[model samples]
Target: MSVSNPTLITFVIYIAAMVLIGFMAYRSTNNLSDYILGGRSLGSVVTALSAGASDMSGWLLMGLPGAIYMSGLSESWIAIGLIIGAYLNWLFVAGRLRVQTEHNGDALTLPDYFSSRFEDKSGLLRIISAVVILVFFTIYCASGIVAGARLFESTFGMSYETALWAGAAATIAYTFVGGFLAVSWTDTVQATLMIFALLLTPIIVLLATGGVDTTFLAIEAQDPSNFDMLKNTTFIGIISLMGWGLGYFGQPHILARFMAADSVKSIANARRISMTWMILCLGGTVAVGFFGIAYFSANPDLAGPVTENHERVFIELAKILFNPWIAGVLLSAILAAVMSTLSCQLLVCSSALTEDFYKTFLRKTASQVELVWVGRAMVLLVALVAIALASNPENRVLGLVSYAWAGFGAAFGPVVLISVIWKDMTRNGALAGILVGAITVIVWKHFEVLGLYEIIPGFIFASLAIYIVSKLGAPTAGMLSRFAAAEADFRLNK
Candidate 1:
């Protein structure tokens, strides 16, 4: 009924598993491509779970629960937005990206694909894209580092600064050793463990507090707002909250999985599996947070300080509701969320540097071995930067991610979407879109205003500008034909 030694043991085992997965992947790794894309041989299950795991991340564990805890049922709208966006992204982007990247001589990275696909004479497109990826992804990766540090600070009482380096180092070491395949495989395993923890913990908490209906009744009785789906926000705020869904269209980490999949045929299966897992795991985490309120409200004596602040809902829930054995598992689940995400982001940033910038521009004939080393070196450098920045590890997960997500979504989302669907999307237009998006996000964050998030405005403006500017550009016969083909494909597919 109380904190037990078994819970601590459970946690150690979970950490050991993470380390083991990395080492196992490290030994089997042969070269850069294998490290970055698993040599483009990932099956549906591996792609599905790895993608879902990487996507849900600490945002799911820490951000979503904290939202539900602080704002009650209103937070679920973000889930709804994400589910809708994820399903559409897998359907539209995944199948085509797999084929397109393969068709373009098996392009290895997002910037590589972008450059190769358009055959732009200017290398400015690739260089600019690489810079944007680095800038936004650094912020994104730092946020994940923050999450990992908070995990230790919240659960094990480790100080924030120490935890930051330890978590970042662990992720960077494995990611550099194993590369993309290792990350995906480890992601698959870490993701499964995370889903198990999420599902098992909520069910156990609900049962201990009584049946499902009893838990619901208790939460509703405690605060009517807890049951209200739109508890404390206006229409725009709610929409802005859920608007996070739109960022998926531009995320490099998620798109990289599609490019790495074994084949296009596997995408349908991957989509089905990934979406189902997202709904279940994300839904379960929200329930755990919501249910934690009921358990705590009913037994306030054991509540401690966490109830006053929802950021620690998961941590508090693990301590109060389960015996140490199960609590250890719960704690591991939290780490699963943090580590899986941090490792993925770190690998993506390193991949951007090695595959997109170095291999393409610096050394056209670089061996895979050399490329892999560059990736590993970048991993160490970026992780060091992230640890240095995570001085305040306890910042809101969603907010941290939002700044970076909005940057990527606005900067790349429009250009990426247009490039696939509108062939005349010029190098100039792409650059404009990227610059506009990045600037808008920076401005929006510094100068907060009403209405949807900065991403929405940035996306719309970038899309509009690209459309107008691309139309004005003098297109070659080849470019015009490509545009026609894109239109034809859209019509036939629709």
Candidate 2:
């Protein structure tokens, strides 16, 4: 379908506004810290929303909803898993990370945090962790690219290659110019757009399909299994689905929000706001897919796009049900989702390269201005690699996201959680955990072991490695003192 004038105009205006925000943020970004972590000065609302927006990404709209539409309510387990995981992450990790990162050399990236926390003088932790981030996040960024391309391809009738570059252009522009501040600010706006689209679209879908009761009746008529949340799902399947929650502890982009918050005190309020937004958004996503079953069943003639690609359900519904102007606004939410996450992922990759590698190894005396510019250049470099990875039109957004999600969760989740909470977790232990977690995920994913999600095994083994290795060796006295200081600071803030 050719893009309508209103849709085209909306797209143009939204892209322009995001780019404008980048320029605005550029004025505030003066140093490496400002460019990478917004100088640790984000308020609770922006922190909360930005974290939610970045965490949800395109998968919340396209991947999760598409899964539900194809497999019925059974697929909602992933949402359930994520909600549980996100809440725990906020409760346990958010405040502590804020305090710990600040105390531990004011670390700007996850690898930086790991290195400082363990006092890894050899720089092995920093290098390995940075490599893991680059490898997985490159894949993660590609998922965003794939999602954006899908949006453009379906909306504008562009070829996959054209859509791929077109979709990535705006995100890269803002991230390249403004860095973290721009990404966070734009994320707040994008989060609002996403929730509006998600909540509003499902309500319209319900009304268009008659009502909730009528919608359920139609769904049941089409397939009784549509209502069965447990239909055809084995115990392992449910465990694998719920295992998605474990990923929350390790995701660098989301954790960066915690590290960047204005204060540890902000974490409580931010957690409340973030969780509420997440639950509502997840519910809307589920509603869209569940109700979409009825809407399409009652009007099969208009179901061709969704029938071909279940991931396009939200996109198809937005275009078909709403007026041209309203549809344009709603459709912009897809771009918003794509940009919010992709921009942050790009920034995180840039931070890993610039802060962890470039300044640490390549140029110890690199000035703040120089580092900031190098960071921007890294953003562009990562974007190009991601675009190449996403060149395949056949790549599924969920498939790519799941792999990268598992990679981060397993590779860094146990290490991060243990580092903050357990003083006895030695540097060797931390290194063991990282290696074990990452390798387990890679191997398990390759073998497709027991049909269990790689994250489950990866997390379990990583945690074990940390414990066993720590038992063999104790933390240095200096390490213990730093841990105590962070804990005291956290208590005061709490």
Candidate 3:
């Protein structure tokens, strides 16, 4: 199939704008801190939108709608869980993390904070945390690539292999050139595009289906189960879905947003803005997926594409329900979702490599300019590795996302919560918690006999490990002192 001229132009313009932002950010970047965390100068709106954009990713646009299309309202439990989790993360972690990270030796990365907070003289905490980030983020970033490949394959009628590289190229170029500033600025734009597309598409879809009541009836006429919100929803299933929220505490990219905010006071405003955007976009996404069911029911023969690939519902509807120019803009929303998340992931990976491993261990005396370039180089390298992992056409974006989400949520979530709120948390406790949490997620995912999501068990065990180990290891005087100082500083800032 040949590509439409309007869509091609829109896409080119969008990509060009992103690259230009990168060049602009490159000019502003003077040191490693500016490259990695935007010099800790992000305002409320940028912080909120960037965090939301990076957190939602393609899973919001593709995996989510696809699931709702196939599984009905039951799939929405995940969204509900995430909403609660995100709120708590912002309320509890965001302000505290910003203040604490600055107070705790002005730590630049998550691993840096952990090592500094615990006074880990042996560097074991930093190495293990960085390794976990690298391992899980490789798989996490692959999900975003798969989503971009799916979009390119459908939108431009390209081969999956070609689409894979093309999908990653723009994200890599901008992230490699502009660093954190570039990623944050692009994410703010992408988040706006995503919400606009989601909001507009749902309204158009609902209107075309005659309205909510009529749409629900059309869906029920085909399959009554499609309208049932609790068809197969069990206690365990709901728990598992909601467990997605737990991953919020552990996500390196989201946490980076809080760490980069202009001040502690900015967090409250950012949280409110972010939550509002999240709820509205989530509602829109659910409506679009549900509307796909009705639209297909009204035209059975025309449903082949959606039936063949549920993830293509949004793309298919964009073309069918709107004019070429408008459809192109709508489709760019998918690209926005993909690029926003991928850039953030690559930046986080680069930071982990540069701040946690490269500067800390490999080159202790490296200059600011050298560190910035090294970070950029790692961004390109990490994106390539993720692209390779995403090469397989059989991978489902949601499945990959779920696995990685569980890995990060279970492994880091418990440790982060304890470290910030509990002064008695020891270095050994943090290490044990991370190792136990990460290992449990992997082991539980493989066995597949629990009839529960892996995060539930992984979180439980990880939290337990931290408490038990902390008591056994005994908190050192330095750890307690650092905790007190962090608390005092947080109070002053708040």
Residue 80 of model 3 has an lDDT of 94
**Candidate 1, TM-score vs. the true structure?**
0.93
Looking at candidate 3, what is the lDDT of residue 323? 87
RMSD of each: 2.7, 0.7, 1.0
- What lDDT score belongs to each candidate, Candidate 1 first? 0.78, 0.95, 0.91
Off by over 4 Å in 1: 1-5, 474-494
Lowest summed-lDDT stretch of 10 residues in model 3? Answer: 222-231
Q: Candidate 3 — which residues are off by over 4 angstroms?
A: none
The TM-scores of all predictions, comma-separated, are: 0.93, 0.99, 0.98
lDDT of 3 by residue, 45-123 (tens): 9999999999998988899998988878889889999999999999888988897888788888999999998889999
Better of 1 and 2 by TM-score: 2
In candidate 3 the C-alpha lDDT for residue 398 amounts to 93
lDDT of 1 by residue, 342-420 (tens): 7778887888888877887799899878888898999888777777776775466778888888988888877767776
Q: After superposition, how far is residue 456 of candidate 3 from its true place, in Å?
A: 1.2
Count of clashing pairs, candidate 1: 4
